[model samples]
Target: MKFPISWFIGLRYTRAKRKNHFISFIAIFSMLGIALGVMVLITVLSVMNGFERELRERILGTVPHVIVGERAQGVTDWKSLEQQVLQAPDVVAASPYIDSTAMFKSSYAGTEYGILQGILPEKETKVSVIEDYMISGSLNELVEGEYGVILGAAMARNLGLWRGDKVTVLVVEGSTVSPAGISPRYRRFTIQGIFETKSELDSRVAMIHIADAAKLLRKGDKVSALRIRVHDVLNAYMTSNYLRANLGEDFWVSDWNRSQGPLFRAIQMEKTMMFVLLTLIIAVAAFNIVSTMVMVVTDKQADIAILRTLGASPSTILKIFVVQGSINGVVGTIVGVISGVALATNLPAIVKFFEEKFGVSVVPGDVYFIGFLPSELNAVDVTVITAVALLMSVLATLYPAWRGSRTRPAEALKYE
Candidate 1:
């Protein structure tokens, strides 16, 4: 029976010849290396993607989306500005703010430095995301009441204060400068309730009534800034631009992207850099593919001479070796894609399982944000990684495939 081109020759080329055990082992190692490299890259990238997502949802969602404020001076006619800003596209709400840094003495007589954010709770939902983040107590309580305070969970722990506790703010509101340098002003406040954001902000920030904060901070009716929340996060920048264009020269609007710009950019750069460096591991494995194919070409020379004499073209010989090399490449690529996707898809559960059983930590929360390896499998990422690995594998086969095709029937059959 006349055999098919692939069956008659290609199958024979890929088979593990009994005499070249070392070549077979090299092929196995190359495939394994590719599989491992692809798996690790996919897993790590997914974790980074997960981190980015968490930052946006948990961190940004808990923070203000935009801040509209004056330059070094202060906002004029804020209610008017609020109306104008609200007219911008995607602007959901606007809240006036009186934010300051001061030292607060707890009930235990121990004091610590922190941020005091004075906001009108009634209007807060218009501008800040904080209202939705209320784990306890009403924002109305923080607004209508005098000297009421809301403390972050971590800040409450550090200061040793609780609801209904009185804490005094020792403001260095620049001295009543005598003949001396300065004398600090003191402001007293009552802790209203504790709030948790589960972010770094929770450890150093406190919230209070804008009216009360103005009274205590000696700012009168003047709010330091205008906090604005948008309906869509992606349109934040465009809305900010609209506000900036209309809100006069003294006022400026900044969106979440501009506010968190540097931090996110750093993450993106670091992830890209690390991924590039890790790809060298795949390159090393491709070199193994080269080594294996070279050895295969040497071991299969006599078979090459027989084929050449039987009218197989040099290109046909090349295809035979190419197919042989690509089998290792294709097999490794397929297995690696499967393994990587599987590991990425189930990474969180797998880590949890191991943690429960062995009490071992794959990631730590204090060191890394919300610890335990988080994996978010992106299909595009998998495709890109697999394509790159296959490219490297194909490149590695060139020299050996060419060498196999160029083998002379005379010399190769002389010792047959």
Candidate 2:
């Protein structure tokens, strides 16, 4: 196969021998650096993607898709409102709830404040996915027993309480008596079950029977909000808008965005920041491409001059360098892609293997939301990363190629 003399010479020069041994090592390191950077960036970004996916599945699946409530004091007929909203397109399940801030206490520890949501078991199962992640006991326990309560895994950890353990709550809403005002009401509850959502919900919220929570709140058979679950979460905002338009101005509706706004935004922003920061590694490594090509031009100055005297065009010289730099990009990118994909696709298993062998968690449950680091290789993300690296590689060639083109045929041969 015939090849351009410039390409043949360019490639040969790129492979450093004894005289240019240091250049060879620098070239190798540059390739490795690019590989490492691309690998880490892909791996970290994949993990972030995994976190986002888990949040959507485990947290959003169990939280309300949309919540409708009366904005002002007195409670309207939520049951009637629920019926109307249920008829909205894409709304799958709707349940009434009474939410209030309360202080919970137990024998082991005291002073745990959290949001207590009153849910009707039968109705709630249709709405939230918590029924799937119940670690212990049953949701039916709440319906059967008046004093039954369910706690999130993290909240349970904080209280040092477990299923069948007795817990007491001081309801803030019931602090006022009809004649005797500002008297706190206390109720004893048994821990019926524990749930593991592995998100912020696990640390901050607990559940009880709807009737019991309403009674405790002194709402007298009324609910402050109706939690609605839709067939599609991506369309949650649409559902909220539909409910708001139909329910009129007196009623207020909240989507998952409103309920978990800060958390979702923070996660997204952190992921973005991580990708940006990690890309710097790739950028730094790519700089080596520029340096390597520059050195190559210096070492081959005489050859370039000879080629210029032999009728080779400056554009051809430029193409030669560009091609050489691009080869570096291609080889580095391929190696990084393979290794990074392997690491990401198997992160869960990799962490598990290390934890079991070493007898210590790589990703401890206490620190992160998951006990292991999660990773997901997204095609779009990989494509974007590769594209950026390729672009950087192309850019790196321009200076060296231009320098090669400017070689004076006469001066370069003066030593001869």
Candidate 3:
């Protein structure tokens, strides 16, 4: 099989040993640099993607995807409204809840302020995963009229309280007016359960039976909101909008986007900035090919003159050098992608191994939401990185290849 003249010569040039070892060094360096840059970018992006996924599962899992509430007062017709919400597109389950702010004080520890939520244990499971993280007792222990409370692990720790312990809860929202000014409503409740999400919420949230919450708030058969879980959490915002439009202005529809959107958006922005910054490393490495090719053209002046004299067109000369330079990009990109994917996929295991070997924790569970490193390789990320690298390599070759093609045959021969 005969190869094209330009391809054959170009390949020959790539494999040939050059007299100037400096040019050879630069070529090798550029290839390695590109490989390193690509690998790092892939691994970092994968880790970021992993963090995003973890946040969604760990934090968002226990939070409502969407909440439907009355604009004024509480949701008096929540049972019927919940049925209506269930009929909405993408709605998987709906549970009635009462949200209130309160301060909890324990006899053994200090007072802590947190969000106190009221929920029906059975119905709560349909919308949130609170029951899954229980450290002690059960959500079912929160019986109506018992005024039972569920404390977050961190909050429980800070309050030095445990299951079956008594905690005093003070609510300013439902305070009563008295002769000695407004008196804050308060209740003493026994802890029924404790849960840990390993997140900030663990220190900022508490829960009780909806019936108990209703009585404390002086609300009869009314809930603060209808918590809705959707089939796809990513579509929660859209679902909220649909519910808002259908449920009318009298009802307020909110989603995770309102409460947690900023955090995720910040993560995304950081990822983008990191991508742009790291891409510069690859760009610098890719541009190194320009210097490598330039030196190659200079060293091959006599060869170029000879080829031109032998009826090789300037365009053919350009193609030869372009192909030679492109070989470095292709090889580098392939190596980088393979290594990066491998590293990203096994990152968690690798971190675990090192942590075990060193007798140290890279991600502490109590300090961070997760106890181990995580990674999630994305095909789109790999593809984009590959394309960018190849493009940069090809572009870098243009100037040098064009200069080589413009060499004068007569002048080159004279010097040779």
Candidate 4:
């Protein structure tokens, strides 16, 4: 195939052995730097994306998207409120829940503090992923009036409690007045099940039948709140507001954003900061391209002079160097993209392999909310990274190419 003279000569120059070997080394180094930068940036971004996805699907799935309750008292008429909430736009499911802070005392492990949630097993399935994460027993085993509790995996382990074991739950409320003073109410509950979500919730939360919780809290036939799930989780804030307006002034609505928004925001901020920091690596590589082109321009002055004598225009001279520098950018970017995507796609396996090999955990579930590394490569992110790299490459070439183009045939040849 035929090629433009500038392109052909530029490529030939790239392949040619240089008198100054250091220039060739710098050229190679620049390409490798760009490749490494792109690869790392893509992999890190993919991991961040994975974390965000897990948070939305796993953690958010367990927590209510929107919760409605009476501002002054518990929702005594939750069944009626549930029906109303289900009618709201974007709302998909609603379940009555009772919540309280309690201390669980195990015969073997002393005591632990936790947030207890009362849920209707049948209705709970419509709103959360708790059933899917059950490791010991079924949610159906939590019979009404049985005083059975489902403990989170971490919480259970910490308390040395297992299914069928009995634990004492002490609630600070519902004190009994006596001659001496008031006494907190307490109840003994059998452990019916255990669940693991690999999230912080697993260490700080427990569940029981809503009916049992109501009795324990002394709020007969009432619940603390109504948990609602929506079809579009991103629109939960708007849905909460809609519930507040439609449900009247007596009820208050709260969404996941109010309770968990800061954590998600911090993750996003870290991702942005990481991208900015990694881009500097690519910038430094682009600078190397500039330096390489400057040296090339100096070395090829005799050739530029010869070409000008043979009727080559300054524009042609500029095109030659631009094409040469851009080749480094394009090749490096392609390699980086291929390697990055490959690594991101198999990151989980890679992490597992290293973990098994070293006998150590990279992402401990108790600490990081997940036991393993996650990755999800986004096409838009890859495209943006590639475009930025190419732009920097082109920009780096301009100055050296302009300087080369201004070489006068008479002056450049006189020294030779």
Candidate 5:
């Protein structure tokens, strides 16, 4: 089988044994460096992708996409407002809720401050994932007059409270005015259910029936806010604007971006910084390619002279070297991509294994937004990484290949 002269020569040169052992070592090192760099970059970026995905599915899933409320006071006619908001485009579901800050005290534990939410059990499932995360009992048990409370898993553990245990809830805004001074309003609630999301929210949020919440907050038939879920969460900001315009100036519309935007933005910024920093690894590997090619050109000067004496052109010499370096880039990139994808795909299981073996949590449920590592492989990110590596590899070959082509047959022959 006949091959093109340039390609045939290039392939032979790539596999040819070099007299200098150091050059061989350098070639191997360059390939390994590129491979390692590509692998690490893919793995890290996948983990970052995982974090973003978890934020969307877990955090955003729990929080309302948008909240519409009266600017001056709670919404007294929330049912009418809910119907109105639901009629707006992109809005899928709406639920009325009462929110307040309260201190929970258990007989066995100290007081813990948390956000207390009042939700209609049947309607809550339409807006939040709380019902899906319930570990024990049921949200429906939170009867309107029962004064039952559903505590987050971590919160329950912290307060050492269990189902059927009674806890005291003190609301600062609902304090009573006395002859001497104002006293905090308090109520007793029976622990009816516990939910676990393995997030920070699990340690900071508690829920009860909206009717009970209104009574405790001293607000009759009124809700603090109307939580609305949209068809596309990413378009919540635009939907919020639409709601604001449609609902008029009497109400204020807020979206998840206002509440959780900073955290989301920080994650994105960090991902970008990491990509920039890690690209330097591939660049360094490319430099090694430059060094390896330079050394090869020096060792093959006599061969270049012989080829030139036999009528080989300088352009042919350039193609040979470029092909050799590109082969290295292509092989390293292929290997790295395969290995990196495998590692990233199973990162969560690997993390869980180590955590169980070591009996220590890398991501604690009470601290981070998620308790386990998450990984997502994006095609765009992988393509960008591979392209950047190949481009760098090709660029690194230019100076050395050009110098090799510029070799003078007469001068090279005289030295030989």
Candidate 6:
């Protein structure tokens, strides 16, 4: 049950109340600072993680992970191309699609431009979660030749259209040569469904049956591309490159990175910046430990001289101070981690409570992709924060401890 002499004395010194209340106050302040820094870092990082997850699951989930297409002309043999796409590594599902920009005009809502996409309901379900977000009607209602269309919720609201309402689609790809200097091809489509993604896409995307899109565009049986969903969205860029290499130069393979890379990259950069900025809080707290330790060393000078007289070495005095300073860091880090995790796990509820109490929305659906603040605690984030705090704490003790160790036994006791 015997402890090392240095450790025993260090523990005793830490437990004893300081005669100088100011020194005690500094020590307590240092401990609290470390705890606050760690807690804020953990909670903020968790919230960022949640936003990234939502981007992948909610926003990207509605779009294809990868697209395989012919460089010249549409994919005439889309069925075969779909099969090839499915054979590629990481490919989970493949569906043929015809994507084009078109103007949609409704009698009640006027006109708006958006991406018009053609899809087979059954196959589309495998590549995207559009079916899950349907607010009314269903993708199955998009019968071939029926010219039925699905509109985004915002688009539908703006157009003042509902199920069975008619909208005219105008495309410039298949204009006819008339005496009136070529006319744009157009078609009337009945609204079959409406979906709400709560994303930017909700205002600028529309869908219809593949056959109808092909006919409207005069592409015959050909499709613009084969949409591929991968097992992991994070690796879509690599998977797309692999497909491109294997599919040859005649075909082009693209992934979500082509369209959404900038957005996600911006998010990642923000996360990195936040991590760097927040770490300064912990660094500042660690500095406070230095000042606190310095004061302690000054107060304990006579004690150090007495211990040295009793055969304690300089190294022993150093170890004693290091142990004492480290205790503050250890206790603070433990408290911070516990509270941070608790706060992070319940962040959504806390946000909701505040919103309800104040009658103000923290995240509005119109302004953001999601309507509520989200949080996802990561173990790696917690571990890294803990390691940084502890390292800083231990490092902060070094200079003060070294100074304490250098105390002259004769000089220190001469004053007493």
Q: Note each model's CA RMSD in angstroms.
A: 3.2, 3.0, 1.4, 2.4, 2.6, 1.6
> What TM-score would each prediction reach against the true structure?
0.88, 0.88, 0.97, 0.92, 0.91, 0.96
Clashing pairs in 6: none
Count clashing pairs, candidate 3: 0
Question: What are the Cα lDDT values of the candidates?
Answer: 0.80, 0.83, 0.92, 0.91, 0.90, 0.92
Candidate 1 lDDT tens digits, 23-54: 88889999999988898899889989988887
lDDT of 4 by residue, 156-261 (tens): 9999989999999998766688998878789999999999988878888989998888888888987888889999987899998888888999998999999889
Instruction: Point out where model 3 deviates above 4 Å.
Output: none
For TM-score, the strongest prediction is 3
Q: By summed lDDT, which 10 consecutive residues of candidate 2 come out lowest? A: 9-18
lDDT of 6 by residue, 1-416 (tens): 88899888888989999999998898898899999999999999999999999887987899789988999888989888877777888889999989899999999969989999999999999989888889899988999988999999999999999988999999987779888786888999999999998887789999999989989888888899888899989999889989988889999988899898899999999999998999899889889899999999999999999999999999999999999999999999999999999999999999999999999999997788789998999999999999999999999999999999999999998879
* Count of residue pairs whose backbone atoms collide, per candidate: 3, 0, 0, 0, 0, 0
Model 5 TM-score relative to the real fold: 0.91
lDDT of 3 at 374: 83
| Weakest 10 consecutive residues of candidate 5 by summed lDDT | 2-11
Clashing pairs in 2: none
